[model samples]
Target: MSNPYFQFKQFTVWHDQCAMKVGTDGVLLGAWASVERARRILDIGTGTGLVALMLAQRSLPDAKIVALEIDEAAAGQARENVARSPWQERIEVVQADFKKYRSSDKFDVIVSNPPYFVDSLECPDRQRAAARHNDSLTYEELLEGVNRLLAADGLFTVVIPTDVVDRVKAIASMNKLYAIRQLNVITKPGGIPKRTLIAFSFSNRECVIEELLTELARHQYSEEYIALTREYYLNM
Candidate 1:
């Protein structure tokens, strides 16, 4: 059986009750997102509140973070994880679908490691499938929510499979959210990029492109990857 919890440098995430557990994708999105000066943040489809906690640790002490999860079990576990973290007071876990969610106040930064499998076979486990497949939250719907809740200068960031990068960018453009930065995530030194991290904003700026090699070899992490995630990983 998988471990019930993942212990980070500053926080512990217990994911036994969550459909999706703490994994590299969530960690990468949480660590790679630029949260500098963000006074208010939102994490959509937060499975175990990992990204929310990480953002809380990175953002200003006065920053407030809201983690939205559609699944009841996952949202409850996220709340439990947040309650145990140092930033309990700063993070709020809300059980709600992002597409139908509403907020009076806009967010300075919005991040998500959303369900991206658009055409793949669904997992037999209904909850796991919803957490991984985009049927529960399509890119169009996700971007629509970001467009509605984002501040004028706010940024919406997400990590998705490389195959869907272009499609997502097109959708973002349709919503008037232009790509500002992108990071290609390669698993090994010579491997093809499997995921791309993108940040979108209201203004059309020159997109800054960068590459991140996660590992030099099997079990050997790259310096850049280690450096980016060292703050949260317990043994990095």
Candidate 2:
């Protein structure tokens, strides 16, 4: 099969120029985001337009989805991917950094699989490095931007490494965004938790946390994982 395309049950993602391909992180964020009744949605750092397309597929038919990508090549590929989707008319990909892109209207839902590897080693390619590093879009910048662009009741969802959850929570608190729901994901029964999928809102009520396991063993998927993503994953 084609290395550049990842075919889902409802949609297919074509990711040739993006530094990151269709991965578990993107899928987790897409499947985990709260799309119920959301009329407008934004996908920050939309590499390959995967999350945006997933949101489009999950949301109402009239929903408007916007995807923002910083890398030129990735943005071009994302545009192509979005245009070929059935929700093409409802989705638009913008070639602009999330920090520099200005939007007057606030979205009902905002999602991101942001680059949270702070102080990490840099890669050789400048674009890839920028996409992977926190230098181009810091956590502070992301939270501030979300604060500015998200509606009062809008939900912001993201996926990050488990180690970064505290830092992200602190940043979100500074911006007055509270973690309303969280899902901790592990690879297997006894493995270390690698990722955290979080949902934030402007409310300050007590937070709800949930633990989740993605796989039962190496290369073996769990029933919960399959159930959550069965609509998208073709094999499921």
Question: Which candidate has the highest lDDT of all?
Answer: 1
The reply for model 1, stretches above 4 Å from the true place, is none
Give one digit per residue, the lDDT tens place, for model 1 in 100-186.
Answer: 899999999999999977899989999999999999789999998899999999999999999999999999999999999999999
lDDT of 1: 0.94
Task: Please give the lDDT score at residue 228 for candidate 1.
Answer: 95
For each candidate, give its TM-score against the true structure.
0.99, 0.97
What is candidate 2's local distance difference test score?
Answer: 0.91
lDDT of 2 by residue, 1-236 (tens): 44979999877888878888899999999988999999999999998999999899889989999999888999999989888889889999998978888887999999999986787778898877877888888889999999999999999999998999999999999999999999999989988888999999999988889888899888799998998898899999
Query: In candidate 2, how many Å is residue 181 off?
Result: 0.4
Compared to the true structure, candidate 1 yields what TM-score? Answer: 0.99
How many clashing pairs per prediction, in order? 0, 0
* RMSD from true fold, candidate 2: 1.3
